[model samples]
Target: MFIMRNISIMKTFIRRRHIYIDHYDLSSTGISLNEYHQRRHSLINLIRNYIKTEQKQSSYNFTICLPSSTRLFMGPDVAYFPFKQQSDFYYLTGCMQPDALLLLNGNDETFSTNLFLSSCPMNSINDYERWYGPTITDKDKICQIFGIDSVHSIDKLNSFKIPSSSILFYNSQITDDTSTNKKNLIPFLKNFSSSIVCNQLNHFLHSLRSIKSLTEQNLIRHACQLVSKAFIKTIKNCKKNIQNEYLIHARFQYECTKLENTSMAFYPVVAANGRSNILHYQNNNQPINSDDLIMLDGGCLYKQYASDVTRFWPINGRFSSSQQQLYEILLTVQKDLIKYLNSGDKFITRGKLNILTDQYMIKYLREEFILSRTIDDDHAKRIINYLCPTSVSHHLGLDVHDCESISFSEKLESGNVITIEPGLYIPLDCTDVPSIYRGFATRLEDDVLLTDQGCEVLTSMCPKEINDLYRLLDERDNSDID
Candidate 1:
């Protein structure tokens, strides 16, 4: 999927291919040479609009500094975690390397993107190249490959004297300071120009990122589909009541990797029984007891896009009488909430979801004699959170929890992909809680894509229906008998 083109501006030029590793898929990422150009152009328009609309200036000239991965780590320095490009930087340049900077020059005459890279090691010049490896250091070749206007040495960035009153945008975390590892601009502001203006590119960039392009949708859909298959298989494996949480977690990883060279979006939460009461349970070491209700919170990443789907099921292949009652309530609330996510629907904020869910659940609890009939509105809401400690929905995409630049009451749009998760958790030691509902937790989550007509449940095939869960175990039993 990644290959350097033969021809370049330099006649018969050779690229240093050994040290340069490109794992990113351009087609899947909706990132290409053309896409980069379009993005650069779009930002140019955004700047122009900002200058005219807000600043009331003719135009706001600026230069953006986007640093690449430092590949730096704590402790062992064996690169403990895999190297991933900073999200906003990758979104703009799509360059995968260590110690590189993308400077987007936004001037009146020219809106050109420039690349600055650290020197690559060579065997003849240094011993590090022989032991460490060869990297892409060729200036012309780097330009040709990455589709940038100009390329320079990393040291040139150090000597980058900003123009007086120049707006230098740094792509770093949205902190009060403008420094994220290599792209520190504090020294530039303090030492160099007193009048130089600094700002973060977070909000401006997120505005574009929040909306998924066609290519992004395809990648996300593929990720969700793969995760769905893996989750179904993992659930079926648990029905025998012989597997531990780690085994199920391992099974999910194995299935995702075997199907397609994919990776986990985040660590799997194969919490069984009372362990499900804890929201972020990473320790999947417990055994699956026959009567336990297991919460399988797992997802996989395919080509950088992420998929998150969770299910609550019984180890014995059948929900207990108490489990069925609570599970049905959660399942019903989740299904009902989906109706409000359609395009033009009053934005399904966390607050709105909480209000609606609490009303429904409190009413159900009262009718079923689960909660005290004397329970007031506030207490009933607390009961709802007791079972489901997490929010009903969150944006899902490149990150498992994606596009945070959204308000809780933000209107639902066509391109948005969000998760609808309504869960119920009951701890074992809580005597205050009714005995029937204690010591079990169940959370059902699915990724939904908002469409013009309604919404498309991307992970719909994963099968949350009560019948589907039972049928899966039934099929497994039938297969074993054969």
Candidate 2:
């Protein structure tokens, strides 16, 4: 039954780019480094055991692929390595180093794990290393530290021959294949005839990852706390004179990085005024006006795992009556959605609640003169699309928008973590929208974990209520700016 279910799921699984935040520093709540390392080691072992079990059914050996350096970065600068969290690689190895690979062999009743890494000389001269620092150089030292069975130069992969019974498992799309001379592992599988199968393993890893172990949950919770701190700092920095959105973004990033050796889970959405209407807006170059609403969607990662959270506030430390009303409506929808997030509930079915909430909001808008009464079902759908088009939630984990093979209709499990973000985007020039609702976009998002009872808000530390937000902003303005 499990095999059938997995096979059914694989048919619909489509890989999408996910964002994650790293917040490893927020975990210093009196925990020692040694204790953290011990916890990480246990997590690694747990992942290894699962991988070992998958390899048991086949006569072939198992190989884990790593992200190559070329794939990780686009330029010489450290910032060029576009932020991406490799979930499977992070799971088994617990190493966040980029441009490295891992291979495991378990054919002769002796299980061994081998790590392939870029040579040290490459890092000695690379600008990325100079700026970001090297993760690992000496293969022997890494093997000793991780207690892996073996270590090999990544360049030696092509020359080193594997037995005919070896089967390679990797993230089919996640790893970079740009290197001209590197051994193309996928092509090599075809040379071995029908016995070998190049299986895409990310989905299997995703399912396992969705259900966070006790330790993983604790790490995520800590990461969320750190992000909440950063959010508080950003709110404090929002002053009437300071208009640049990038300044706030930079401040948040600085706080997060300083606190936890991790970076933003993804490129932050720091939109002000009308720009906030763009759902994935990250170009924070706009000047924030005191009268404009600012929406910030971001998170931090802890040891490559992530926490994603979003909050919206007024630049002048208080929302206008209209802005407050719209913001409250979105927040209400988000709060209502949270009530339905639970085990055995289908995410798509839960999504229907979002549609219902949207319809209700539209009706309310019509009554309030924010929407046209003549708008038909088609126009209503378009209006809703403009307001809150995307599903109210998605899976969250190592990647901010983590991998899940199941469709939206699939049943939710107790351990799954997701986002409940309901928003309204009113463009400035839309004649269809009533005058009062123009030029405003409000989004209320929070990380949630499905529990036995219903759902737990992982990002509850960040204020979402209009009154609370106004108070928080006012407090920041009075104490910090002056």
Candidate 3:
């Protein structure tokens, strides 16, 4: 059945490969021709196996979607061309360079993979090639490299006949702008068969991605270490002269860029003083006051996987008595919460762990005179709500938020990557709080993986202890003065 489909598809090269050796220059670290090939091969096998496993239950055809052309300004002069599929393209072709598409047809008996990409301009002097560099225009070479049965220019999509019983799996979220051309091509396939379904492919792909195979885990672990080293460098570089939060953010980025496997997983949150209260703060534009507590929440992307972490420090190398008290409370809550995140444990509510942690924090606050009263009814409710706005943990993987939709009562499995973050926000204007507790906000965040026995903290390289943070800050300041 697969062989017949391939014959029917007629794999022909409509686009020629125009290899410009200069294209490699666009890569800051130069292109790894070998890595690209290896990734494609790895993905092909993984997908084949997935299809085989699925075929046992039912017969369905699989199609992968790619991101379409969208302009990304690398600089004022250089722009990046778009691609069709994201993970699908990356998995099948290992082609990071965009504006490509892929289709895989698998029946219960056989399967064939096809690559559809943009054609190279016939004119040699095309400005896009000169400005942006060469792309894979040759269908033959791509077919040879990826071992796909056939390759064709995207223009041939309309002529192709899709099997009626075939299942078309593509990203449901492909935007009109990114997939306008592909959307036109979909109608042609439907003409051949009414069985075409734009099933959600990302769910299956994300599930596979969330569980770190040995190779994937190593890549993420390397990224974690790079971020840890960058954090250390950023701390050491901190001095009295650098007041601009943007400057500090740049420093962290500079350090990460030096490492091969490191870059910000997401925008760094360099919030100082009260701004730390805003959970996803990315406007690192505030001035860093000597007396303010600075919160640095950032991570590095390792081989496309992510590592998320957060650390807090006093700008002047010493936390005041009030700051120290609040910081300790947050740290203690995080530590205790982590102890309960064991494998197979089921949480009854979405934020049950966070709620419990907040309860402990409220008790500490009342006992330490941070809160005037420990009234179990209104006071306790207010304390819990103020300290933790969201759940203490969330699924974390390739994307920072990761992708498990399973909710409370679902038992945590061993391979899940999650973040444990507990925070307390104290507003300066609040008249209800004691003077010592006002204007102080603190949060401790770390990424961890659930193991069979317990859990392992992937981002624990950064210090979280109140004493350790102060000591490191003081050491940095003292070294700077010398």
For every model shown, what is its TM-score relative to the native structure? 0.85, 0.77, 0.79
User: Which candidate has the highest lDDT of all?
Assistant: 1
As for model 1, its CA RMSD to the true structure in angstroms is 6.6
Residue range 1-482, candidate 1, lDDT tens digits: 12334344222222222223233334544456787777777776776676567766664566776676666656773663555656667777767666566777775556777776654333232344566555444567667766788886665576765444556666445334332434443444343344334465666766677677777787889889999988777666554746688877887788777667688888888888688778888999987777776788888887777899998777778887888888888888888878766535645565676667667777776777877888677877776666656777888876788867666776566778888888766778756458877776768899988777778899988988889999887766544211
- How much is the lDDT of residue 252 in candidate 2? 81
Maximum-TM-score candidate: 1
lDDT-sorted candidate list, best first? 1, 2, 3
Alpha-carbon runs more than 4 Å astray in model 3? 1-69, 73-93, 125-130, 133-136, 176-198, 342-360, 366-374, 377-379, 404-410, 477-482
**Each model's C-alpha lDDT?**
0.70, 0.66, 0.65
Q: Model 3: per-residue lDDT, tens digit, 1-482?
A: 99987755553222233322113222232224454445444444455566667555355555444444333566985654322225444543444544556666655556566767655534342444666566444556656555567876576676766665655565656644444356655654455356545456665555555555555556666777788878877887777557889988988888777788455677889998689878778899988777777788888876666787788887787877788888888888788778777534654333576667777777777777777674665777775686567677777755677665445434456677778888888777766568777777767888877777778887778777766665676677555421
Error of 3 at 130 (Å): 4.4
TM-score of 1: 0.85
The TM-score ranking, best first, is 1, 3, 2
